[model samples]
Target chain A: MAKNLVIPIGPQHPSLKEPACFTITLEGEKVVNAVVGTGYNHRGLEKACEARTFIQDLYIIERVCGICSHIHSTTFCQAVEELAGVEITRRAAYIRTIMAELERLHSHLLWLGIAGHEVGFDTLLMYSWRDRELVLDVLAALGGNRVNYGINTIGGVRRDVTPELIEQIRKVADIVEERNKYYIQLALSETTLAARLGGIGKLSHDDAIKFGAVGPVSRAAEVPDDIRVTDPYAAYDEVPVTAITDNHADVFGRTVVRVLEIMESVKMIRFCLDNLPEGDIVTKVPRKIPEGEVLIRTEAPRGEDAHYVRSNGTDKPDRVRVRAASEANWHGMKHMLEGDYLADVPIIIAAIDPCYSCTDRAIILDNHDTGEQSVTDWRSLREYSINWYKVRGIDTSKIKIAYSPLIF
Target chain B: MSELIAEKQALATILEKFPFLEGKLEIQRRQRIISSALERPLFEEVFGFVTTDGGFDNFHLVIGVDDGDNLGFIYVLSNDDKVMLSLKQSAPKSNPAIKSVCSVFPNALWHERELVDLFGAIVEELPEGPTYPLPDGWPAGNYPLRKEWKVEYFDKVNMTYNPPVTAGKEEE
Candidate 1:
């Protein structure tokens, strides 16, 4: 006998941190269908960027996602610079590459920690965060800030990596490398984790390509689609990146691919440090950008983040459209979540390392005939979820709650 | 020569039936930038050809730009040729309706909804998505991304606006 139940999880929920909701229809324990609704934390950045100058928009785009802030600014700056026809120096490119790789390290480690926490392995969460600090320490040493290191300027990088900074980064990379070995061993060899994540939330190779899955998510599914390798941006042409892929497309495959990619990032950072170019970090550009449209795509920590900038010969942009990596990756999540257990939802959602804030800029007005759909505030959504669980005989009072801002 | 040229030639041949598509198609770097002021009737035919025969299999991103009197929708698609195909179409501001390419690219469901919500461009054949980014009870006609749209604060708490007094006013 099949009992069908529609379970709604988040725009605001304790299990997920981001402002995105998953409404999964379950037939007993198995998920019959799932729908994801994001855009709760929409900041209207693309529209806002049109009002601000190219320089001001750098800071605005950096706030897209705190985790992948560097990549956002890097991609935006690249697009604007390309429009202005200003080529930054080799040193600047290498510095940008180093920053980008360091960001990937921090972001993947953060995801690893969250994945651990979701799977009830608090030890991995604790250890990964402890190691993650090393990457942040390196970032702080270079850019003078832990997160959103305003390092990227319009023409080039704002900060220069001195010999001392390089040494510090190298040391941190060594520590990260050591920790990576242990994590890889644990994540791959541990039978408990294998039982939990293996064969769960599987995205087939065809679906990954068809759905436009990016970064490690696609790579984990054995799709060799990496922006760094395919279209070399920044110092990638000079310092090539090896695209790491795993045959397994499930949650475990995603974990393995990300963990291994961290090691690859470590190697790339070392290469940049070893072959640091000697030149000016920035190039002087005129106040007004030349009238043209340009596209800049960079490999963000999560995936291939692209920005389209249209300049109308003014300091202010005519239009700025950002196609976030998570936007492409979310389709993969929707494809994976169906036919899985309701319990596996949290870890699988985190597997893509989705940044809902980065992805959801446009508003969606859902008018489905299901009659199950309704426009509810976070307060109402939270109350509804609590009542929903109570009806299922779960005690809500015992659970400790954490709150994130619902900034739509 | 390259697959890029072959794809371009194939696209030109397929699009030869519509004269508007002429001079609008060109290869920018590795990408085929197809920009044209498409008529409502021609939208599906052109988009379908590109998706099926043109080998622009992957649907990347769909962005709607407000051009004051009209709204421009850019549907970017790509294939193994590693070239992005940008299919640009415009809808009049008064009507604000364009044919949805969601059928051509199934993954474009969210992208089409974005056009509907932000740019107020009506997408035909696509169902409405959630009123996300904008909360429910937001003014019906208020489209934030529209150039003419100005910011207005709704009194959620029903508080009266009190002007901030100058720091030296009390002392003075």
Candidate 2:
């Protein structure tokens, strides 16, 4: 009971693809506390944007989140275009929607692989990643690049989806759908995977609401908050969105939501391709943006990706703000990690699909005995409230008694 | 059936309810423009309208504009009905500060920070500090988004990493 052990989970951990550390405090195989350390991959993209022209900023924004690249560019473009008072053609909007959906499909598949690996299902990881490559191939075929598809411009999309590529996308969609179904069955059937995920890292509806959680995480907890349906952008208004939700509020539920969402995205892509409207991809964007501001939100694979853009009567925008979904769900990680087995920490953290590139650096860990502190797992801060509160003279029942009576 | 007509009606309704909002709030078919003094209050009203109607569930984007002498912040709010509201608020260049809509939208934190960073416009009552793409050691007074500031040269270097020192097998 007196002894304590500190284990550093990363800067290079198998669970994390990015560089970050999670310091977990162990009390005999059970993690009593966890702390997270970031700042390893801070590129300072926002600061760099100021130095670039409005057109050049598109490429920079696309790199902000590799998986959600299209959303980033679209959000940035929408903001700037609004400032410049440019209206994109209907065909361009459809193309943008299609590209965004493609990104979502690939991103979710990539996440599925990582989620699989997190729970000790390496085969699922391999298969999911292999299938994900096809989506990348499709992206390269359409946008001429896999990662930073400079398809988006201020007025509209820079590239057009040829009829032949649309046919190929349809063919690929069929193949991916068949494979996705198999994986979903495997994920649901495998007892080991189920045991690791089901009822573990539970985020209740109330907790999800309080944290302002979005994307698949909030949907899994039964919150019907999809930006596509709520804020219809691109061709989303014309197309129907059958938003997926699971009330389980667990890792398995999140997986179910994401998998189901992939199916919906495939259907959406097919619809967009079949009804591909004919028109110009882009319009003339004025060099100088009239003085104005605009707030726009688009549905990224993770959740709601919102942007705030301001421009003066100049070529460069006065200000640009990106509120990514990862930043919103970062706080929810604290609630999920507490009172769980030490082994489950990595899987739980992975559930939120955090993007450390968009968040703050430095995670602090304090030792009560020595009054000394060190950088530790960011999740431990959430557990601290419960851990220290239990030791204090404050009684939970008494506190509940005091608050419940007033409510009644 | 026209979006412009619907937006005008919606604007009329908003102005009728909040009588003090007259003249302070300007509506253009899908766009709503407002003075900077009423930006925060107007944001609440617009958000309330969307939530009630269940149409404007999506937040489009927030943009910041700097008029050499003053700063202007514009918010574009749209509903599922296709009606758009473009809201504008102007703050003086000397002390540019306006209330933040993060409390209402939850997504305004990033937008406000970008405004603070690029335009040097302060978002009053914002919980978070400035978070734009500025690098360390950049001069404080210099705001990059202004027309006066020009980029002299672009650095090609990607990122600088500080490797952590390990004390043998004991650390592992």
The best candidate in terms of lDDT: 1
Candidate 2 ranges with C-alpha deviation above 4 Å: A1-8, A21-39, A356-408, B1-172
Docking class of 1: acceptable
lDDT of 2 by residue, A329-390 (tens): 75467567766788788888888887633222237768999999998442355356456777
RMSD of each: 11.7, 16.3
Give per-residue lDDT, candidate 1, residue A59: 97
User: Which stretches of candidate 1 lie above 4 Å from their native place?
Assistant: A1-3, A356-408, B1-20, B32-34, B152-172
lDDT of each: 0.81, 0.72
* lDDT per residue (tens digit) for residues A220-247 in model 1: 9999888898767889989968999998
